[model samples]
Target: MNRQDIGFVQSSINYQFKNLQLLEQAFTRKSYSEEHPEVQNNEVLEFYGDEILDFFVTKMMYKRFSRILNNELVSEKNEGELTKLKSILVSKESLARCMYNIGFSKFLYLGKSDEKNEVYKSKSVNEDLFEAIIGAVAADCDWNYENLEKVCRTMLDMETTNGYLALLVKEKSHRLGFG
Candidate 1:
């Protein structure tokens, strides 16, 4: 991606990394990294971002659902449950929607060959890019837990539900034929 594209992405996230190289790495797919052995892929950042994302989500859940008993929060304990929830919240579909809404798609750096690939246009790509961006932000800035939480909350649409209680209520009603 050009410097202008990078600037656009940075503006969208409202956080710029101290090391532009880190930001570049975050956008660099394994395919491109293979061609440039000196550069790194976003996989490691993806790993770190994955953990940070889970922590942020779990903390939000606990904070928002403070009235619920510990045992009642079934989805908090199970690995599968957390994974499922993350998939919904952090999925490519959700991330791409968020990015597109914020105008980040225009800054993406897909290889020339994959630029037109249908998969590149899929939500998975967007989600992956978002995770990579998170990794980049964490690497670039002094993103403490509080700021990270704020970012995740904004990106995941967590502000509207306060731990999804309203969603749960609606879901339960629908299950019982109330819908």
Candidate 2:
């Protein structure tokens, strides 16, 4: 990618990569790597990122809904509810929406076949890209919690996600006559 394209991606995600190569790899799909044997695909990064993303979102949910009282942590949400919310936050649809919001599809490095098939339009591909980027950032920053958190929050639109969760909670409370 050109410097200008890199800059656009970095600015869009609100984080700059110290290792630009990682960023490039994050956008590289398996098909592209198949064509260029020397180039690495994003599958491994995506796997690592999927785990990290899960942990990060879970942590955020815990902090938001949990409280310390009598030296014990109590969560306002039940396990099932929290799980449901986390699933929603990390859903393919949600991640795809994030990619769309940041206009990231055009930056993906796909093989000719993928490009011809318009894989960029696939929600699954978009979700994979989102996770791959997170993986790239985590690797670039050496897994620094603050840096990863910042990038995830900005890239995934945590503010909006939190707002949506709040609405859900409020609606549930109101329905239960507890609000």
Candidate with best lDDT: 2
Return the lDDT, model 1, position 112: 51
Candidate 1, residue 134: the lDDT equals: 79
> Can you give the TM-score per candidate against the true fold?
0.71, 0.91
lDDT of each: 0.64, 0.88
Candidate 2 lDDT, tens digit per residue, 1-179? 88999999998778999899999999999999999999999999999889888988899898899999999989998999798888888989888888877778898999999999999999999999999999999999999999888888887783348545676888689989996
TM-score of 2: 0.91
Q: Which candidate comes out best when scored by TM-score?
A: 2
Lowest summed lDDT window (length 10), candidate 1: 158-167
Per-residue lDDT over 98-154 for candidate 1, one digit per residue giving the tens place of the 0 to 100 score = 765666555555555556564456666666767787777677666676656655665
Q: What's model 2's lDDT at 9? A: 90
**Candidate 2, which segments miss by more than 4 Å at Cα?**
158-170, 173-179
lDDT of 2 at 175: 88
